[model samples]
Structure formats: structure tokens, C-alpha cells
Target: MPPHPRTTSPPRARRRLRRALACAVTISGVLLTTAGTGHADPYAAPFPAPSMTPSTLDARYATERRSIEQALRTAHGVGDTGRARTLGAFLRPGRRFLDFDPRGRGQAVEVIGDLASARRVALLVPGADTTLGSFDQRPGKPWSTPGGGARAVYTEASRITPRPGLAVVAWLGYAAPKTLSSDVLTDERAGQGAVALHRFVSGVHRVNPAARIGLLCHSYGSVVCGRAAGSATGGAAWRRVTDIALFGSPGTTAWSASALGAARVWAGRGGTDWMEDVPHVRIFGLGLGPDPVSGRFGARVFDAGPGGHSDYLAPGSPSLRNLTDIALGRPESVTRA
Candidate 1:
């Protein structure tokens, strides 16, 4: 009777039974098959994963900047040679210098609009690292490339109001900072640049005294504007500069618009920008005043959406549209979208 206890299943048999149970359970449940398996669901699709690569963003900007620069260059070359030549005259090396010193020749650009009536004029001051090369083209290029953010402003002005004569000028006479370091950012160079800008504005007003002039400053350019506004130079007395528009600005809070004598001041910032998070402290007594976009500053604020730092001139952006409206003096056109 005790020997009968040995009548249990063999190890191989037990293993086989376990394997069979596993197979049955697997077949009864939801099945997943590899790509090569014919049992796989044909309709199941993979999701598009979000990109987390910095290189991808850099490549995107590089491609876009290239395309825009090419288009601008083509447009600049095709226009009436007489006007282009005249504008090119100002864009030359000697004319674009900082000195109003008899030796200092100032640079200028005129974008012609409707001829029937007097028009609004916009003087665009570019930010740091902007050269005649970077003014319209990408950095490190020798030849002037067109269709820069400056040109976009001109185009916007032209399209915004076909009635008022619109003359958009890209004034690159000042030497902008070549980098973003605090040393360069806080140098006396900003004040020097401001002096140059004042002269450029004066020269433009001299040419078209009756035009309603608007000053559009971007980034470090805003610093220049603030400085110029605070200067006591006769050149700052120009009556044509009616409105000052600061976009993607970091400073404006430090100086009062009334002190600068700008009739109207407008400030805008694109949402989701890191600049807003940047400490507003002035370093080495060189950094600019306060944040103009802060409601405490009392500037007419417009929403620039989520384009961040460089979104001001991005095509089809709300910031661009708002800029067009502001340049054209179409206050009603600025919607809060």
C-alpha cells in the first residue's frame, strides 16, 4: 500500500501540463504579436512622439532664417535700381558708422508707399549682434542679404495701410553688441549706440520732416532707444518720432517715456519667453531700466502670444500683425487674440 504512493505524474509530464496551461491562458487573453507575426492587428498604429532635442530646434531656425534671408535679398535687388541705389548708399560701411563726426556717414533705407498722401514712417532699430550682414542675412556672411526682420516690418507697414504713405527705414548706424554676455550688455557701448541712433533719427526727420515717425526697437535696440530718449542732444529734438514700440524688450522700466519725450510708448512680450524670467537687475550700472511690459510701468501693452524672443517678425504671427497695425497707426486693428 505504501508503494502505491509512487503513482504520481513524471517530471516531464508535469512540465508538459504546465506548458499547455500557459498556452491556453495566453490564447484566451488579449494577444500581442510581433511585426513579423501575421496575427498582429493591422489597424494598430504607432503614436508620434514629441521631440526633446535642442539640435532639432536649432536646425528649424537655421532653415527658416536662410529662407527668409534669400527672399529678402531677391526683393531688394529687384526694386527700382535708383531707389535701391539710394538706400544702398546709406547702407555702405562709412555711412553706417556711429559718429555724426563729419567723417561719420549715416546709413538709411526708404521703402516707398502710396504717393497720393503723406505717410507714416517707421525707423527700425535692430538688437545686439546686428550688422549690415546680420541686418538682413545670417551671421558670418559678407554680402548683404535682404528680407531681414527689418524688411518684414516694412512689408507689414506697406500692407497695413495702402492710403498713408509708408516709408520704412532700417537704421543700422549704431554698432550693436556682438554677444549676450553681461560685460557687453552693460558697457557704455549702449549709450554710444544711443547717440548714433539719435543722429540717425534726426537725419531721417531732416529728409522727411512732415512724416509721422515711429520708432520700433527690438531687444538691445530698446536699450539704445532708452538711452537716446534720455540724451540732451539737439538730434533728439526731432518732432517726427511720435510712437516708440518696444518688442521682446528687457528694459524700459528704468526710464520714463515722458523723460525720453516719446509721445506714446507701447511694450509687448511673447508668452512663454525666457526673457521674462531673466533677472531684471542692472549689472555694473550698465544694464537698462525696468521691464516696460510690467503693468506697473504704465505702457500700452499688447499680447505677443507664445512666439517667445524672436517671434516679433515671425510670419503669420500675432505679434507681426500687431506691429503692422501699430506702424500704420491703425489702433483699432490691434486685437487681443
Candidate 2:
């Protein structure tokens, strides 16, 4: 018998195939159990649309505040204390929201600092499981919610030298997937989020034409930013985006930073983030693709320090400082990993 031709299965290919199958099984099982049970929010209602005019921002905020107050009254009338409590927080003095909606899972775009006069703006896109009720759950704990996280970054950036007036937007403009669900594994939600995010950024530019914008994307929010970066929908507004920072990201769907169409891309992952174990492979739109921090992805790697998935924005952390630096367009100050 003729000698059998030598055969080998590449390890990298095998690993990817195994991960693909695992993803398939996970998606199938989750779909079977979760079909038609998306848990729609019962308190959904439309509110006033935002005013993008820089001169009218305060008026728009005032309009939204009044709408929120009405929503709070409605929530109280409906006996939904949880929703009422969340809406009540928005009524507090000095809480400036660019956009507010009481609809499903809710949407809020809160500004921390003066947006009207800011020379630099950081838009903080949060990850999964963020909602109105959980907006400020842990209050001063910073990392506990998107709003608190943005505040922490603002606090850190305020301390930067040659203080360039910076504004931070806690943008919960899309419905994030539940952290425990299979939805987080794919970019479906991200695709929808990109459109909303793109519009929001465009509006921001319209309001402040001179300001430089930076995206501070966290976890699944990085996926949203990646999609927005590569999206062909926006105009010169995208050109105003100076930097994009992906932290604790599973993947950006793009193969590399250059592919994201971003001017500059920075990536980091905390030393102890559990997301490190997630497979970085894309198969038939099932996975999130290459890890952003990997050399292969070609992003500027930064030191995220020894923290968990949610600790990237923790007060006084290196990751927070690096994020502030990136937002302020001071890449020279960012600590490399």
C-alpha cells in the first residue's frame, strides 16, 4: 500500500472550530429557552425629543426635566414605585440630560460638565445590563452605572494639566443586552446601537462644532463604537472623532484599529477581567472576532492595571487615568501595558 499522505490539523484553526461549535450550541440553547420572552418593560412611554442647538440646550434640558417629572407622576399613579424612584432622581437639581426617554429599558444621555463651552467631549458608551432603574444604583461607587462611570472619568480629566474644558456624556442611547444572555455574544444589538450612536454624535457636533470628540467604550459598548466607526452612514461629523478607547472589550468585530476608521484607537483590558477567557474568533457572525488589545488588532495598548471587568472606571485606577488622557487627546501620558 502506498504511504498515506501526511496530514495535520492546524491548532489555531482547530481551536477556532471548537469555539465556533461551542458558540453554536450556546446560541441554540439560549434561543430555545428565551424565545418570545424578551421581558418588555411595562413602563415604556415617549418623551420630548432633544434640542441639538447649543444655545437651546438648557431649554431642551428643561423641557426634558418637565417631561421626566410628568413621567414620575404617571409612574406614581400607576403604583410603579421602582420606576417612579428612578424618574425622581432625574428631577434633582443640576442633572443635565441631553436626551431622556422612559421607554423600554429607557434611554438617557446625561452631561457632566458644561457641554455648551467644552473644547473636548468624551462620550462614554456603557456595556450590557444598563437601564434606568440601575442608572445610579450604587451612587458614588462610579463603576456601578454608566452615569457614575462618566462622572468618575470627568473628575479625573478635570485634574489634567492645561485644563481644556472637557464634557462627558453618559450615553445610554441603546438597549443593551442582559449580561447573562446569549445576546451579548453577537453584534445584533451593536448594529442597532451604532445607528443611534452615530446620530447622537452628529447632533453633538452640530451643537459644538469646535469640540473634539472621543469615545470611551466599555465591554459590549466597544462593539457599538466599532460599528459606528466603520459605519458609512455619517458625514464629516465622524472626522471630528479624535480617539476611541476600548476597555474590557470582547471584540470590535473589526479586524484592526485601522479597519475601524478611527483617527486613533486605544485598547486595554484589566489584569483580572474575566472577559479574557472569552474566545476571540468570528464565525458566521457568531463571535466578536479578534481581541482589540492583541498586537494583531493594531490598537495602541494601554495599561488597565489589576482590576476586574467592571473596575476599569474605578476611582483612582490607572485605567481611569488612561481613559481621561485618551479623552483629552494626551496619548503621551497614557501608560502602556
Candidate 3:
């Protein structure tokens, strides 16, 4: 008796499977080439701890300014003209930073408005490849940097009718993955980033106890926020963060919003975002988990329009307006997708 067609394994089918596996392996190898190459910043210098009182905030900012000025000089002395140029911008008056360490890829925390008097505050956590050099000039993405994006959101918030006392923090407080490396495939960096983010939130609360905090996480930054919100150590700091918005996310490494421990969670993705094609599953400590924009995730999905991954905060875009609404604590005004 001949074997049943269903039970037979054809040579063509076997070859196809082998080809697919080979292609996946090659792609993985290409991405992992830059893994484990990250090094600590040798020029790092500690600044003052965050202040509790509004009166002392100016002093904190001054200390950071001095640190940046010194870093700029060092960069110039070393002939690192690119880094020197980026650092020089922050030395200008009216530019306020809570933290600035020009070491390794560098880290900074910038405030767009008066945080001390803010009734509503939004902290933006950026994604991978975010370094001091790319802070304002991220190749193809113009307004997607921590500083630029935060400023754009701040500008949008200012245009809101009956505007609230809103402030935006461009938080580049962690060593984000600098390339499409194996580091981004795991949660190691996210875990470290979560700790840093938690500490920053606590500091923000100390500065403005009355402020209601919201988190605006983009791309890989969403994973960092997710880990912080769902951490076992999440306590008073987590409580102060009333809302979280995840945009252009790969995944939250979580199944649903309840796991995030946030009161109100909102999610959105651009209509043309390439992240939609990323494999949404977690296994062997690899791959970001379920999609937050999916119905099963149980988050309020907003209309992001037909922008690409980096166009979410483009001036006058629907995503930017909706993000502004979220930052201003006006959920009623956010248009649903």
C-alpha cells in the first residue's frame, strides 16, 4: 500500500523549510554582530542628587551645566569635534538638565517646562541607538530624539485649549542599545533601564509632589517602562505614575496592561510602522512579548494616522496631538483608532 499523501514528506517541502531556517539564522547573525561591544563611559562624573524643593532645582541645573561645560572642553581637547558640538548646545542659557554625563554614549535628563509648578508631567523614554551624537540628528528621523521629541510634545501641549500646567522630561537616563545588537533581543538592558527610570520618577515626585505623572515610551523604551511598572520593587514611585503611553513599541514583554501596574495604559502604532512585522512572542528570553496594540492586550488604542515609526511626534500630526492630550491629562479629547 502506498503512503497517504498527508503522511508523505516531499523533498521540495523539506528544502523550503531548510531555506527558511537558513534565512532566519543569517538575519540573526547579522544583528548579533554588534553584541557585547558596549563599553562604560570613562569620562563619567557624578553630579548632585536630585533636589526635593523647587528652590533648589536651579542649583541642581547649575551643577549639571558645569559638568556639561567641562565635558565639552574634554571632547574638544580630544579632537572629538562631533561630541564637542553636541555638548556645546546644552551649555547655552535656558537649557536645563537634571542629569548630564558625557561618558560612553552619554545620558541626560532635560525638562521642557517648569516642572516645579507643573500639575501634569510627562516623561519620555527613547529607544535604541540613542546616543549623544544622535540626540538631535538621528539620520533619517529628525524630530525623534529625546530632546527634539520632548520639545515637540511641549509645543503641542502649549497649543491645547485651557492648557494645564504640563511639563515634559526627555529622559535619556540609561545606556540604550547603540545598534541592532543582541542586547536588544533580551531584557538585560531593560532591567537596568527600569531601575534608572524608577529612581528618576522618585526624584521627580520629590520635586513636585502634587504633579500627576505620565510616561510616554517609544520603541525599545516601552520595554524599559514595562519592566519598571511590573517590577516587584515597584512601590510609591509606580503609584505616582498614573498613566503610560506606549508608541511604536516592539512589545511590552507583558501579556496585558494589568501586568504593567499602571492605572490607565494607552497604546498606538503608526499605520505604516514596520514594527507591525516583528514576531510578537517571547521564548528563551528572546523576542519582545505580546503586542500592546493588539486587542488582547486591553489598552486604549488611539489614532496614530499613517506615519512611519519616527513620525509619531511630527509637528501637527494626529499622533502628536493625541500624545499632547495624554500629557495634559485630557483623555476625553483623545481620538480612538
lDDT of 1 at 189: 60
| N/CA/C clash count, model 3 | 1
Q: Write the residue-wise lDDT of candidate 2 on 91-181 in tens digits.
A: 8888988887887678888999888789999999998888888776765465748888988888888777657699999999999887667
lDDT of each residue in 36-148, candidate 1, tens digit only: 43442211121222221323323433343333333334336555343334334434432221111111122223233421134677767777665433445454321112235
- Clashing residue pairs for model 2: none
lDDT of 2: 0.83
Return the top candidate by lDDT: 2
lDDT minimum window of 10 residues, candidate 2:
1-10
TM-scores, all candidates, are 0.61, 0.87, 0.88
Alpha carbon deviation, residue 319, candidate 2 (Å): 0.4
lDDT of 3: 0.82
Off by over 4 Å in 3: 1-31, 35-44, 48-52, 139-141, 232-234
**Please, what is the whole-model Cα lDDT of each candidate in the order they appear?**
0.55, 0.83, 0.82
Please write out the lDDT profile of model 3 over residues 1-337, one tens digit for every residue: 0111221244877646644653364247446655345654446585665564677798898888888888887887778899988888877778899988887778899998999989988999999889888777766556789999998898888778546689899999999984346776777889999999988898888888888999999989999999988883655656878889999887888889899885689999987675665667789888779999999999999999788788899997999999889888889999999
Candidate 3 lands at a TM-score of 0.88
Model 1 poorest ten-residue lDDT run: 97-106
Q: Per-residue error at 111 for model 2, in Å?
A: 0.5
* Better by lDDT, candidate 3 or 2: 2
